[model samples]
Target chain A: MHNTLLTTHYPQLTTQQKNTMNKIQILVIGRDADILQAVVRLVNKNEHWNATGTSEDESAIELFHQHSYELVLLGGGIASDSELKLRKIFTLQNPDIKIIQHWGGGSGLLKNEIQSALENNEGGNFNIVDNPFN
Target chain B: MANTVLHKADTRGDANHGWLHSKHTFSFANYYNPERMHFGVLRVLNDDTVAGGKGFGTHPHDNMEIISIPLEGDLEHKDSMGNVAVIKNGEIQVMSAGTGIQHSEYNKSNNSTVKFLQIWVFPNKKNVTPRYDQIPLNLEDRKNKLQQILSPNPDDAGVWIHQNAWFHIANFDKGITTEYQFKAKGNGLYVFNLKGDLTVDGQLLNTRDGFGIWDTDKVQITAETDAEFLLMEVPMAM
Candidate 1:
């Protein structure tokens, strides 16, 4: 009854709004909460992309299973073991999923990396930045 | 229908960087083919020939299983883990960059090039610890039969990685035939022809060609001539 009531009360969505709802879902995994939030904000700047951020491996896995993510961005600061586990889990669930390792660069490099990964019609881990910190 | 894909020798991506001449069977650095990214968890298959006094500098990799099989000459390897070694034509080397590791490789000879295969496989387990292993293989064992070079089990035979995969190399005389059974139920097999002509199932492959097959229990391989090849069986779901 509650589900039916909520559904009946839902407002009609316009065609443009419905189209905007088809944003590509992405999962951002990092160890630092601040950086994770910042990366998520950068990812959300794209009109056609939506991102969820997590600072823990467990939460990342939970969110991954809860949503149909097309891409996963692994930010710096994640432990090597955690990064490997996340990669294994994500790939096992969706073999076609694209994963990119996000090293620190400004928002420009971040956007370029995300856009390139999404636009490239290939599947595999892409480590674009090679020691930007250096 | 059974799943199958083929890559002829000439169709592979070629990169001639003077000292380093390489051919990529799958998508690799500066060579991105969406349809040829990977077969199962086999990420990279690079046929590399490094000139004398040239090699890869110290670089870092994590959460990957990197394996190298020398085809000619000797490759000198030095890593941050304090492991310094040389892998020759009859030897294989594997590096488990679990957490993170920096390593460098160079051709040990000053007058000759070192030819080798650089393969990358996605590991099943996460960061355990970095490791390095290399072992000399008996070429006689592969005569007219498959010689195991790599596997998941540490005690089985050859070196081990953190994945449920098996690698074997064989040298068959003309008209030799064999049947290979899948070690795992949901695994796929990638065949790389090193020399001469061969046929897998019903597909013909020439030197330096690659063939991938899945969704089957076994495959029949027949050598059209004196041939050498590598068989890599990897999981399809991961």
Candidate 2:
């Protein structure tokens, strides 16, 4: 698997302001190729968000350690135990990062989840709740 | 005259990842065939069986009409729209990924496999607010006759999708004959035999066989044996 990154930049800003305007990074994890591609395309549509998806646990973990991601979207392809372990690792590394589990649905629900997560991050609130469906 | 094409069941791409077994009628995921990319507006037709207690995790879709028809066992569905339901054998589910949506499906049973057909069609109306609907299958009305299960009309008899396509399912006894005319002039029909044997437009089809026809008014189907099938009519010009 080659590393493919879709990056966005904003011009006409000061050096520090330009850094602040860099697109929000989102890490998506799932085993389904179609789902991964959809996530990347959906995240890139906003231009304010950049997403990278990988099915491999090691790859996702490595990516998390290498970059500062504001959120992580976990796909249903992973087991419950694995999801928890990954969530623990992600929060431990960055307390501000928001993680949400996605069961299959439509894009509207996905955007809502992302919005909720972003709001939680902005509020500086860190609370993990058990997903009733899980 | 109708332009006809036969897409045999065996020629479909197969993906088996232990917990899930899927067969794709058109290009999907890692399976890409340029010539077999789509059947007009019909983008994907995947026959899938998920292992008990396992399923697809949350996924995103937009600008597509997605449908699910369970053939065996039960499938648990959850979406970002706050819909959580179980679709069984006698039901049909549709989701319009208009602006965007996220959802997941898992087999609810721990001891049995859940088999279902997943379909995707390009929406004629784009970027509308996403919606979801599931309807109960009327088993009594479909015996030896075509039963309309999905259509573009919101007020129609069946569930509505965001595309100008129609879907019908039927269970025919042996020696039964039926005719299905296209609902729209420029639409093409994809006939998929779910079980038994049948003759469609003078072509014999066995279990899982698929036949696509366009440029015609109607197609004749004669059941050589007890047969169950799904018929989908979608626009060819989209």
Candidate 3:
């Protein structure tokens, strides 16, 4: 994967000390071309998610490590497995940071695995998918 | 004087017809309050729950962006656009109600209660063809984190809205802090704590409580404990 990010450091946010910006900063990682394209289209509609960057480049890890973000989305296939990728995420990202790993097609945590882990991992906050939107 | 925005999550106009119970986040047509017309482009947020073997009959809408998020059960949807789909738990669905369209949704389960959220946003562009899209969010994406669920541009994953708003859902771990930045210029974030406790803009927000700040570009949110929250950033001078 080419390092498109190396040439461009996260744009130096204008130094103006204007009022605090309320946009939600996000970092998305994945290989699904359609999904990444969809994000570009969607961000055009939502003025709230100030999307910082979307990467299919294997350099997603370095990009995430070097920048400061509010949320990060790990698209499917970025890594081989879940546990290994998750560990890498926590190690480099801020302790209070947010991340979402979109398992591309199928493979990763099983349903039971997620259910069981939810209880302990969430620290008692359960908004577990209780409904569906169609 | 404008009417007060009747946005209390609990003190809402409700309709329960056995099969479903819906609470209007803001005033609806028949339940109108002049002041409650809207808070920016955030027109409607109806908290709906459907009973087993029951759901909404086919309905028609136009010139809006409709998003349905099932919080509890499964949702079976059929649209006049020849679209048949099911949005199960953890799924985020969006329909551009442009150029008018008709659709029906039902609870696909037999003995389970279905709870969901219906949020409406004003469109940036008018009269585009009606369209539909859905995405199944993964457990890892939302596990102990806030997921970007809605954006105006449709560039990232998840669903797209037609307006200058973004909706993010997250399940925060104990003592985790998250940050948010607005996409549009001159916009700000309004933090809504759905469950648990949260501190945004340095103020504590309990379940169902919301605090909004405008004229700012970015804000920080820290969870005192495990929590679920939604952040809405919209233009203030609209």
Best by DockQ: 1
Q: Top TM-score: which candidate number?
A: 1
Q: Per-residue CA lDDT of candidate 2, range A1-134, in tens?
A: 54333334345668765544497888888655666677777766765777778777777888899878988887534656777778878878887677875423224335545655676521111123423223
Predicted candidate 1 versus true structure: per-residue lDDT over A37-99, tens digit per residue: 666776777788877777677777877787789888886556666767777787788777777
* Winner of 1 and 2 under DockQ: 1
Models sorted by TM-score, best on top: 1, 2, 3
Residue range B1-238, candidate 3, lDDT tens digits: 1111213456666767688788765555234334443456665666789998788666555546788988888999998789999888789899986655668899999899889887776566545678999998885786677688888777975778777778888888878986777788866566667788888767777776656676666777888878888777765543
- Top of the candidates by lDDT: 1
TM-score of 3: 0.59
TM-score of chain B for predicted candidate 1: 0.99
lDDT by residue for model 3 (A23-76), tens = 555555544444444443343234544444444444656666665565554443
Worst 10 residues of 2 chain B by lDDT: B28-37
Model 1 per-residue lDDT tens digits across residues B5-53: 9999999989899999999897665576767777888888999999999
lDDT digits (tens) for residues B13-124 of candidate 2 = 8989999999988766556554565687787799999999999988776557889999999999999899999999989999987656778899999989999999988776
Between 1 and 3, whose lDDT is larger?
Answer: 1
Which residue pairs clash in candidate 1? A81-B127
Scoring only the A-chain of each prediction against the true A-chain gives TM-scores of 0.74, 0.73, 0.51
